[model samples]
Target: MSYNKGWRYIAFLSGFVGLLGVTLYPIAISPMIDASEYKKIQKEARKNIRQEDIQPGNMKVWSDPFGRKKPDSE
Candidate 1:
């Protein structure tokens, strides 16, 4: 009985540690590891984008597909 209890305790502790590591990795470790790489990739992506491409000039913000006509004054 004592041997079994000891093994059970070991298993429980191992599982608890594993769960803690998994839960904390994304919240803590991943940011530290990927922060620089992520910023570099974002910068490269932004370099290809232009202000004209992001502008919404002459484009309707929203349109009703149900054929509802908006007032001309609006």
Candidate 2:
């Protein structure tokens, strides 16, 4: 079925409004938290551990076999 200009205009306007709402929701409404709670979260997020606790990763030693020039023949 073919839609006339009015239906198309309405659909476009509705889509634009929906897009605006989705984009503005996060900016318009943000949650407020206690300073102590925020600090606890920050401290937990920044917790540090000794580097030695983790096992060593793969140690690759690549020797360039073709990079060296050959000695000149006497």
Candidate 3:
């Protein structure tokens, strides 16, 4: 049995992409221990909470209407 040249090329490309993702995934999620921006933001948020400036009642619970399945009229 013979396979198309295009199929072989596609299979090779897919394998290459999968391998690339596996190799780079660790590097992607590896956090920068040097950055203090997250710490700063957390500190500011805590300060706001202590001041009661962040109102819970003012926040609206967001919902995705499209997330629920609708019954078919048919």
Candidate 4:
């Protein structure tokens, strides 16, 4: 019973220390962002997309109203 009590105290103290470390982590770290650099990257990505990459019609597998695609040959 004495040995069990010592181990239980150690476990409780370790758990409390772990909880304190997790609570303090975000306060110890900082993140940096550059707005102009991010905007330039976003503009480049937008310009890279072409008009032909998208198909202009919505077709369902169960039914087709416009008959845009042929049936599968399987």
Candidate 5:
């Protein structure tokens, strides 16, 4: 079947190859390649502290300090 010139059969073929790589190559062939660059990012992420990692601020200075109800008369 002939496709319009603008619709790329080459692109479709390349996409099929990529899909085959992801599905078949990983299973039948050798393991997928991994770069060492992500190791640096993993190290940085491990250094960052979570919210509860440090002690919370003093509650006395909080916005709604006492949690008091507003007066009835508007």
Candidate 6:
């Protein structure tokens, strides 16, 4: 009975530790992984961006449909 109890306690402790590691692993590692990826994306975006793309002069003015003259109703 003592041997069985000891094994049971070891098994329970192992399972608890495993679950705690699994829960904390992502919390510890995700920010580091995400920060690196975010930096990589920022660099790529900056490299691919063109000066004209950011200029407001290239933008078209929005036309309002309500401001247009309606065709003469027959």
| Winner by TM-score | 1
Off by more than 4 A, model 2: 1-4, 30-74
Clashes per candidate, residues 3 or more apart or on different chains: 0, 0, 0, 0, 0, 0
C-alpha lDDT values of all predictions = 0.83, 0.68, 0.70, 0.67, 0.66, 0.79
Using lDDT as the measure, the top candidate is 1
What is the lDDT, from 0 to 100, of the residue 9 in candidate 3?
78
Residue-wise lDDT of candidate 3 within 1-74, one digit each (tens)? 86648878799889999999889765664346444666788898887454344547765455576798777999
- Using all chains and alpha carbons, the TM-scores for the candidates as numbered come to 0.44, 0.35, 0.34, 0.33, 0.32, 0.39
lDDT of 5 by residue, 12-73 (tens): 88888999888986565643355345677777887876535454663333367678988899
Writing each residue's lDDT as its tens digit, candidate 1 over 1-74 gives: 34547779899889999999999999999989879878988899899787565769765555676988767994
Better of 1 and 4 by lDDT: 1
Error of 5 at 42 (Å): 32
| Candidate 2 C-alpha lDDT tens digits along 1-74 | 86548878899889999999888765653324335666798788867853445536643344466789778999
Best-to-worst lDDT order: 1, 6, 3, 2, 4, 5
**Candidate 3 C-alpha error for residue 6, in Å:** 1.6
What residue pairs are clashing in model 4? Answer: none
In model 5, residue pairs whose N, Cα or C atoms come closer than 3 Å (at least 3 residues apart or on different chains), thus clashing, are: none
- In candidate 4, position 71 carries an lDDT of 72
Which should have the higher lDDT, number 1 or number 6? 1
Model 6: lDDT of residue 52: 66
How do all the candidates rank in terms of TM-score, highest first?
A: 1, 6, 2, 3, 4, 5
